[model samples]
Target: MRSPFRRPASRSARSTGVVRVDTRTKRLTKRLQPGEIAVIDHTDLDRVAAESLVERRPAAVLNAAPSVSGRYPNLGPGILIEAGIPLIDDLGPDIMRLHDGQRVEIHDGAVSHMGKTQVIAEGTLQSAESVDAAMEEAKAGLAVQLEAFAANTMEYMRGEWDLLLNGVGMPALRTQMSGKHVLVVVRGYSYKEDLKALRPYIREYRPIIIGVDGGADAVLEEGLKLHMVVGDMDSVSDKALTSGAEIIVHGYRDGRAPGLSRVEDLGVEHSVFSATGTSEDIAMLMADEAGAEIIVALGTHATLLEFLDKGRSGMSSTFLTRLKVGGRLIDAKGVSQLYRTRISGWWLVGLALAGLLALATAIMSTPGGQAFLGLSGVLWDDIINFFRALVGLSPQSPTV
Candidate 1:
């Protein structure tokens, strides 16, 4: 009689916890604690943001913007619902007024202060069925989104013609990437899994490791020293900046570099790479310009769905950049699968056993070999007899 996607009436369908509010979901994720209510202003939430929230195990997610908005079936809302976290959306800008650490109650799409009687605000409580319907609607809008994507791509190309076509404005880095394998890591998709999978490739090739923003933390988290950190410097931690990686701030072509001041304040030396795309785009551009022999990309978006999931028109740079670097570019997932450990432990053991067997065969085929074998057998028997006698047992006659 009732929809299965909706929570059952028997179970309490309310979330009560302290709220963590931020318009930037990436920055907010850094401080989100378990059971905390995340109050974000994200629209068409992407997979990476959803994954960060899932990792924090939030009590609920309250978005001031539409989670789907018919914007090409964004993956964030479905991830939250699948993780069993309640999602309340379209709460409007008024919800951002909620202060951090303010205890609140969320019930039936309404938010109320803890122990208060009046609802502060109400929103659409999204469930599995609602998200599914939204995704279908979003998919239909793909044609319109594609048209916009094409237009934006042309605009980006026109505006940054020199950079795209001629590789102009690329920063000169001390980290030598010429004729070497370069690993460019971005904090998107199944980055953790991809990074773990590339451990062997990373060890074997010892590629120049480059981390984009929070990806720097991902690198350091895995106990790897980052050779370079390239981004706007908004999402990366101070520890990552001080990690001794050459920090290259991604700046606008208009010369406005907001992230530079933060680096200056922290007293970390950095250079600015004036570009017109995402950090990952500039990272690849840098690698290509530096003449990297092979570029291994980890946690980067490579598909149309992934580009749309990022919710940015500037992803055109990624499309164009990939066209330029696609020859050398290999997805970390592919490398992990194709790469075999050059020397497997089992292979080594088998080779050792075969060598001993060959030696034994050669020894059995010769007179000198037979004499040596006989002496070895006699010595082994004598050693066993000596051990047996020391244990207070009468030794039996040695084998003939």
Candidate 2:
């Protein structure tokens, strides 16, 4: 009979590393290094968060909460499992007892302190089959989420109808958007790919760039200048905050903005916009009210699964915001796949060179042109002789 303690192939039979722990996945990922163990408290981790951790390439992921809680079919755990990163879930509150940066060894789904034989925590290893099973079960729970989302939407619409309709409480901004295209970037699903494909549009139109929260960092990574940034100010890098972009902190409807302190600590000038929607929604509204000819969105959530992954009760604000903007807004992915720029530098350069060669050939067919060519040959010889003399080399006579 096979041993009951057999380990999954995805897990390292024996691995040891220093632990980096955080209740927030974004903060933890920033400090996490390759080959180190990551300890997070995220339940039903979303794709964006999972992608961030995958980029770091950690040795293993230890979660205090269930990676897939069956609330919805979250894609995070499956992504990690497929990437060949070991995931041990539901290790319980005892796992949090371990101090940060402490050396630990993992073997056969057991975690033990380095230089000690005691197993501090044990968890079941997640596999493809197991994750798929959990997801199947989780689909049933999506109905509950959908109902809740609808209720939230109704409540939000009832409370914020005026703000959604008339763009009330929008703060004044220095960036001008009148009669020009606006590019509103969010660091959401497939943002990198979508951005990569929109290079031509960005180059040609030169749209005003508005980054939402950590999306500011994404803008900077693409080597584009940020005209404005709107968000709660969490998950954005200090470098991005200091990059001279106009900062608009997203505050609650009650006028409480928690992220203002970080901006103040940096000694940067910023404005506060008290609103009742996602930062992306606020950004779209701002661009629309500023009279942007067109608004291009990159990495903004559009699907039900995406909204669910974000843990939003409903997309009521987003829905109403879209209605407010009407036909002005366009998704980056759709635009990238459809829109094509007419001119390229190489094409223009080749055309210019072809035109010049044709003109030279036409000129050479005339008598005056022949005389000019002879004169030009004589001048070229003179230039060669001058260069030879400057280099201390004797000029040789032409061969007969």
Candidate 3:
């Protein structure tokens, strides 16, 4: 009979690394190092989490919950596979029992303690093919997901109609947004690239900059200061919180603010705005209510798949918020495409020529310059006459 404890693969295929375990993938990624194994309990992991893991360059990922639950085509699994990272799916709760910094061997689908041959757990070793198949399955179920999304949107509308329509409960702000551009940054899809692309626009327009949660850190990383920091205080750094920005804490509709304590502990003054929906939704709403002439959104969700990737009913509010903001709001991704540097080599050359013409006009006003011009005119006529003689045509006398 075959051995019940048989390992999944031969010795040559085994991968060995120290495993880091965490219930929260975002927290785990902070300390996760290159070539380490990340054991996480994230269900239907989102694209941001997967990108964070890929950045850490983990040897392989072991998930306690399914990465793709087929609710909709989440972009995480395909991103990991595309980055050449190994992913082992649905390892069960037992995988979380593994201690952090515990070295382990992974062969095919089996995870074992290093230097041992016994299998500790096993899961489905994902490939490009398997991930593609899961995505297709998830795509087929999108209609159902959309129906649920619509239902959630209606529920959200009913609950937040006053806030959405009249900007009810929006707190007053010290930062003057009226008649000015506001740039709201969120640490989401292509945020870094979008931010880089917006440098020229930011420099020219000098828009009021607002950072949402960890996007505060992203803004600081780009050497920009925040005029206002909005969101739950989670995921943002102490440095960013203490950076003298106006803090607005997003609280639940019921008036409980979970992130309030963190800001309080830091001794930073802040205001609470209670509402349903994501923090980003509130950020945009606040800007619109404050009479901002234009609002530029960076790294915020804009597509159908992105809304589903959030795996929350709050995304419904985002849809409603967009409509409320209307023509004033523009996604930074689109801005990056449409915005140009405004300054060009031709403009510089024209400026230089204009300056030279002005300088020449000033010099010609001087008596010495008038004498120089007369000498130049006579020299030019002599050269023209020599040229005409060579061509057998008499040079016309200077106009009297």
Candidate 4:
């Protein structure tokens, strides 16, 4: 009588707490210190949070991940429990409607309908060991998803996403009008940090900024001006919807466009590009084809881990696509290596005061900082001297 995903009205009355899923396990482990929730698209990798139980443990994990492509074991929640972290799966559609610091309750999952709660973590959930890995994963996942997504979700991915590389297997931006550079911004992924790092470069180079749907919203949130947007229109904000950036909806081969309709509903100017690749990738191709000398990536994904999480065929597609635009493809991961935050000189002064207090307190105490007291000091020093004298004299070496 009712759709499964859309919980009926009557059920809401008895709902004790909302049940959510953990999508990005890896990110959850890296980002959540303790007492934080994990929200994301999907999960198939060993999560960092799980391994941290022996070291930097967290309180619980709230997974926003899809269970087995909409079915099956949903290993994410179970794994969290094994790692000493409570996990919940599938909070429901449109869960992002909740703000960053919003308080809410979760019920069900490995944690016996996981108790009520609130999220306390700060920043994107991803914690890649290296930028290079993140990039490979992001690019590969997008590529695979785009190829298959072309045939099935052509209408939605294209129109809303400005993604043209559908079944055709290339970024529409690569084929069409070429006039400006396209800057892509991805949130949650390590890409966001990359984007921030490359801000100076983007500003100096003056490449046209193209936000990937919600990425557009992220840039604007930071007060950065965007020239275009690409991606499925699902996650983008109302402000991005109304922003004056040029909108080109990526569509299916049949010519259906979701983003176009939404824009038309509000009577906004929009175009369509139907093909077979990700909105982010398409943005790069578009900028390159548009006659831009360089296409620098910000907050972009191109890593093995990222691809696996995308839950689609991305590895091959990303490889081929990048080959199509080799030298021009520059991933801006850790571009901010040289930019260090100025340490407050006052911070050191505070530390000096703390040291003084500890020293004074220890002097007046009976134990007198016994933890710092050395044992067998002269014996240890003599042993060290003997070792130093014999250091370079190997048993088989010639007499020196």
Please list all clashing residue pairs in model 2, or write none if there are none: 149-313
Return the lDDT, model 3, position 127. Answer: 74
TM-score of each: 0.88, 0.85, 0.84, 0.50
The lDDT per prediction is 0.88, 0.85, 0.87, 0.50
Deviation in Å, model 3, residue 59 alpha carbon: 1.3
Worst 10 residues of 3 by lDDT: 2-11
Alpha-carbon runs more than 4 Å astray in model 3: 1-12, 344-400
Write one digit per residue (lDDT tens) for candidate 4, span 17-103: 332233434433334444444444444433222343223444444434433232111123323434444433344445545443444
Give the clashing residue pairs of candidate 1, or none. Answer: none
Instruction: lDDT for model 2, please.
Output: 0.85
Query: Candidate 3, residues 78-181: lDDT per residue as tens digits?
Result: 77877777888898998899998899999888888999988888888877777777777888889998999999999999999999888889998999999999
List the candidate numbers ranked by lDDT, top first: 1, 3, 2, 4
Better of 1 and 2 by lDDT: 1
Cα lDDT tens digits, model 1, 1-400, are: 2223343221137668999999999999999999899999999999999999999998889999998888687888878887888889899988999999999988888999999979888899888778877887778888988998898888888888788779777777889999999999999888988898788788778999999988888999999869999999888899999989999999987888878999999998889998888999999999999999999999998998899899988997899889988899998888988765467667899999999999899889999998888898889989998999899988878767
Model 1, poorest ten-residue lDDT window? Answer: 2-11
lDDT head-to-head 3 vs 4, winner = 3
Across 75-117, the per-residue lDDT of candidate 2 in tens digits comes to 8887788788999988888888877789999886789999899
**After superposing candidate 1, which stretches have Cα over 4 Å from the reference?**
1-12, 340-347, 354-372, 376-400
